[model samples]
Target: MKQLIIILFLVVIGCRNETKSDEEIDETVYDMWGDFTQVHPEFKKDELPESWYFHDNKEDANRLADLVMKGKKKASSGLYLWYKEANADLPKAGTKSIITNFDGTAQAIIKITKVDTIPFNQISKEYAAMDMGTNIEPLKKWKKAHWDFFANTMKQGGNEPTEKILVVCERFETIWPKKQ
Candidate 1:
């Protein structure tokens, strides 16, 4: 009985030491965001998806709230399950502004840049799967001008067009992890 008690005491103490306290865990998680920023230039807190639940810590919440109030933060990506309304004024292509729920009270405004587009020949195959159909012939006709604009923009940005597409797509996915 005595030996069992001693073992139990030792185990408790060992577990306490190994498991980080709440404060320590919070600091570690907060620091992880800082480290991520250092490595990724385009990463922003506001870009986190609406479905993402962040810590309710006052400091962290306040920081995000301040950014939202100032319109400095914006949603970049995500499954965005709660975003039922898509702004009609925003173009169906490229970057556009959006609003999403950040926390219960705070809302995040985000600039979403859509990197994917339907190829002219594949439009029929792509649209066939959708219930809603529209005349995308205009879009197909504008492909050359769009391609030229994209190419020139890439040149101006000093990025290879193919490389930029890959990077932007990856970055967009990172901001909004796919729904399980």
Candidate 2:
């Protein structure tokens, strides 16, 4: 019957549309990277920038990432010992990286503008202010939060936290998804 044929045709179209949506979802991240490369020709098409969230857990990661996207956070610090223990390369000036949300959704790209290694006890108030996620008591908040975070990192790396431990301070500029 004509009505039966029409129903079958409609069902077939819906199934095809669903398949197309599934394919798009699978390629979403790759497509985002490719799109970035298209806009910034300095980045190589074959090489993708380092993609990572800002912090360990989902809540902190998403919060810090949102701060970066909003231009509120311009810098970050990490334990030198942690990097050495993990044998991870330190972020270098002039290097670009993709900042992702906690769920690995790419949000922004940032270019490292400067890097400094200084003792935890010697981190200046100016530097602390530069890295703040909020505007209040930059030095006090930074010291407390970073000290706690670094203490945990030191424990995980099999090292004890110390006031003299070297901290790698990285300052960056958000380069992609330009502010509207």
Tens-place lDDT per residue, model 1, 107-137, is 3223343432333233332332211122354
Q: Name the weakest run of 10 consecutive residues (lDDT summed) in model 2.
A: 11-20
- Model 1 scores worst on lDDT over the 10 consecutive residues at 76-85
> Tens digit of lDDT per residue, candidate 2, span 96-172?
77677666676778889999889999998888877876768888998998888667644544558889988889989
User: Relative to the true structure, how large is the alpha-carbon lDDT of every model?
Assistant: 0.30, 0.68
Write down the RMSD of candidate 1 (Cα, Å): 21.3
Deviation of model 1 at 6, angstroms: 60
Error of 2 at 65 (Å): 1.1
| Residue pairs whose backbone atoms clash in candidate 2 | none
RMSD of each: 21.3, 15.5
